[model samples]
Target: MSAWPDSSSIPASETAVANKSEGKSTDEKPSKGNREQIQVNPKVFNGETQIEVDGITVDLRNRYLAALLAWLVPGAGHFYQGRHTKGTLFVISVLSIWMLGFALGGFHVVYASWYPGDKRWHYVLQAGVGSAALPALVQGNRMRLATDERGRTRSDYEPLWNGFMAPPHRPVLESEADEVAAWYARRGSGYEMGTWYTMIAGLLNFLVVYDAFGGPLAVPISGRKKRKSDSSASSSDTGEASAFADAV
Candidate 1:
């Protein structure tokens, strides 16, 4: 027969097995709790649609519509996406800047015109603001219709379009050239500022459009990595504290 195991070894072996079982139960408790927690709050782990509009729940699965609405009207996409605060702020700020520019330059400040090479480029920027920039297109077309192919003003359209047209460039009498120069010098800076403000507003709206198309920008993080780092730091701190207590 095999030599009988030492009586003392039996208790040690039983204790080791008991500790192993206890360890397993302790580990399983946390996993079970985690599963229950996940079941209770699934949204935290699984993505869900949660957009609401005007006190009514709505599905925002169609990103294209949101982007189109955003482009058509500043902040509108955010509004539709249930981001009321951002939408309101965008609408107020962008529309205010655009309106201020319009007021400063009148209808003349915002319209599209290609005849003057420098003027057409501004319309490209301004058009980003959507319907707000359309009046300029209408006025530009009306102005075109008011002029004949020979570059002479048509009498029938002149009365309606004269106020909207840029002053014609004509051979200035030497005596009056100084007066024309003075007038332009005084008004040029104001017009330039108004154009800049309007264009900037449109450019800003372009960003808003993109933001609406994509969900709000957020910083990304690896949750698992973060938790591991936190646990390691906590364990180190605990070891240091235990050593200090032993020294005391």
Candidate 2:
């Protein structure tokens, strides 16, 4: 038997398929629209997030996890994503605001109270701060059934943290026993200030979480506008030059 198979024995159709599989090809090129989209491997941001956009792989580091972390603690998502600078700034700013507000209100600013007059509308906004406001929920649950005489509403029965985030008693309930009244007397508008501050912190955290999940804007607003202006200026200059040449 021959050591090598004869070339003539191989079918032409089979030969062509083999040649294609072997990667020997003509000069024909794939159309641009049909070309695969560019994918960026995570590197610059030092994260695991792989992006399909060109020049925009900030390495979001698992957007959902980052978002959850950010929600749990302000700036945590950015930290996970290797964005230390932003993470530090967010942690400082958000925690500072939340702490200041909580202290200003004597730790009563973040309670989740939905009882009648104590609508606790402020808690809705305060919840945005995440964990800083979460203890209120725990405190609320602990003291949920601890009501007063006549099964009436009250903020008594101090629970965890000495009733720190407990619901406020109705103002018309009675005298010195009412926590809300006591808070009003002691803080004197501090409650309002603290509520606003914590709410702001929570709102800020919301923004931070979104940033971690969505990465930075593709093109900066200012940069995009600048590019458009520069392009228009160049176009006008070209038009003027053409007019001058025709006149000349």
Best by TM-score: 2
Predict model 2's lDDT versus the native: 0.71
* Stretches of candidate 1 exceeding 4 Å from the true structure: 1-60, 116-119, 158-188, 221-248
State the lDDT at 206 in candidate 2.
92
lDDT of residue 38 for candidate 1: 12
Instruction: Name the regions of candidate 2 deviating beyond 4 angstroms.
Output: 1-48, 51-56, 153-156, 169-177, 220-248
Worst 10 residues of 1 by lDDT: 217-226
TM-score for candidate 2, residues paired by index: 0.63
lDDT of 1: 0.61
lDDT (10s digit) by residue, model 1, range 123-240: 7887888887766677667756776776544667532345442432222234555423543465676667777888999999999888776554222212121244465565556655
Q: How high is the CA lDDT of each candidate model? A: 0.61, 0.71
